[model samples]
Target: MTEATATRTDAQATAPAKQTKKVHLIIERQDNPNSQPYTEEFLVDYVPGMNVIACLMAIQRNPVNKDGKPVAPVAWEMNCLEEVCGACMMVINGKPRQACSAIVDKLQQPIRLKPARTFPVVRDLVVDRSRMFEALKKIKAWIPIDGTYDLGPGPRMPERDRQWAYELSRCFTCGACVEACPNVNERSSYIGPFAISQARLFNAHPTGAMHREERLEALMGEGGIHECGNSQNCVQVCPKGIPLTTSIAAMNRQVTYYALGSWLKK
Candidate 1:
């Protein structure tokens, strides 16, 4: 070969091999409730239809970093990979969502994962969702039954109301709505949107209507319905697409009527 051609061939051979595209994952992790949080980077093999949970599992199997150093396996919560169970909710790429449904293909490069900061981080991507359930208790988000005995075919619901009620019933207490809500932070006891929607759900039930006044009254109190700032972030993030803001507005109207009714009674 000519000297010039040989030089060009050698230069081409010496060129660095193009690094294969790897799935870069940066996870925010904490060892315990009181420990300082840290970030860990992991490069996992990319796979089609892979979700956050799958990536987490890959890390768990190898527990290695991008530098190929051995590390601790990632910890997270998951159930019903279909997103029906909200146990897998975490902040993925700056948005709170179900890890099982957060497909890697749809996420940005260097997928960032973090525990939902709106709640106490238990460890890694797992968070204590007890506050959400506690809010449910605060709102008494259920229909009270007189007894466990057979109450044959309880009061019927109108077809139209049932249609809307079905939408509210889809909430799995996933905590995504609460995580997405700015008003539900440490500074506020707003009880978040899910509880309010639950209250609306139960309140619409014919039998549940008996406690409608009580639910409304609870919502009227401190950390009640009025705390909602109407950011409307909850609706956008809810996997089930539960109409949260609509429930807030509907409950607001109901509470207003209940307040006026109580005044008339007085």
Candidate 2:
């Protein structure tokens, strides 16, 4: 082949691979807590192994819409991008989950992002998760300690029970279970699955058991375990794979016995 033709052929053979199409996202946005929500489209250069948070960062960096117009940067919460802090929780493509773990490659094209409506929308992809915290407070999901001095080593637990308790302790309070739960909507005061699971976790603790009856009583009150419709949605959407429904059932049995005991005394 001629020198010029040979060089051209080699160049053609060595041509770079076609660029990948950009990732498309339809994000539901709200200007403020009381403002109406609207959908906005964004396109970001596709990157290998990128997660939803990466896509959001791209949009944040550019703050441009699909139509090439500049806009306000989207607002969302995230911490410990490793998914431990549970601050990155949001509804991705209609499922409540952690955005940090939702890999872009696995997500469908034109992925939809929205705040979990189970909580009040703060803005854009941010939601007010205070209610879940309030529920936790209501149930007193904690071990009481005077903290005046070192209490020394606490009581021990059986190996099997400790292992199971460890699993329950994985809860990061992401509120994914609450968002998935139908019983936890605005019309109801349901304390939610994570709270129930947390109550169970603490109640099983050697030191925390001191307030077991109090937690059980909270679970038995209005907007308590009885409010659960048993739709089983909480367990399905939990990012930590916490056995929320199982906790609910166990707490239910405990509440039942507590009620019977209280009635007998009366």
Candidate 3:
């Protein structure tokens, strides 16, 4: 064969490989809360800059599986695709993260998607994150006020303190930190790192400080800061980089101080 023809032949041989691009996903699906969980494999045409949410959307549009059979489209929750909502938290390839931010290009082949098992699975990828919210309530994660009449402006925080509090406030109740934490499993009632961080946030507020001792006491109770195993998985998996371990440590100190003070008074 001529050298030019040989080069053309080589190009022809390689063209098919380059032309065919696919994103493989193995998603864990649960039909209902009482049903057994199973896996479903999917293949989608690879697209540039595609995130897991995008891939799921494609699958939703097609509703076909790897076996060339029609199947129910996978279910998931998502909002604020920009990663602020944290509604799309799931275990992608064994790491809990936001599906909207998990770029396909950054993930390995046959990417595994599972519901954040720390919470009860509502469906395929949707989990009932109410537990985390309940934990928040347990710690009184909000400032209280009597709404009968308008209250004047509340106390202001220092600029430096405000900046850090802003960081803690970034938590959108996404369960990534809780999902990554081993102590936050079914048998454990550990409130997780986000609650401790939130307590820190509220405790810093001059008005919120009125309930600070109550929050501290809550943290000192069961499923509180003492339950943290110091695995540090929470800090690593947090999509917002919220310095969870730092919050946990700070809360630990605050709880200790409060307990000592209470004991002295008694």
Write down the TM-score of every candidate. Answer: 0.91, 0.92, 0.94
Model 2: clashing residue pairs?
none
Candidate whose lDDT is highest? 3
List candidate 1 stretches off by more than 4 Å.
1-21, 146-149
Per-residue lDDT of 104 in model 2: 94
Off by over 4 Å in 2: 1-20, 147-151
Which whole-number lDDT from 0 to 100 does residue 98 have in model 3? 92
lDDT of 3 by residue, 1-266 (tens): 69999999988888986676899999999999989999999999999999999999999999999999999999999999999999999999999999999999999989999999888899999999998888899899999977789998888789999999999999999989998888987787799999999999999888899899989989988899999999999999999999999999999899999999999999
Q: By descending lDDT, how would the candidates be arranged?
A: 3, 2, 1
All models, RMSD in angstroms: 3.6, 4.0, 2.1
Judged by lDDT relative to the true structure, which candidate is superior, 1 or 3? 3
Worst 10-residue stretch by lDDT in candidate 1? 13-22
* lDDT score, candidate 2: 0.91
Tens-digit lDDT string for candidate 1 (1-266): 69999999887787657334468999999999889999999999887889989999999999999888998899999989998989999999999999999999999979999999888989998899998888888888888876768777788899999999999999998888888888887788888999899999999999999888888888988799989999999999999999999999999999889899899999
TM-score ranking of the models: 3, 2, 1
lDDT of 1 at 238: 93
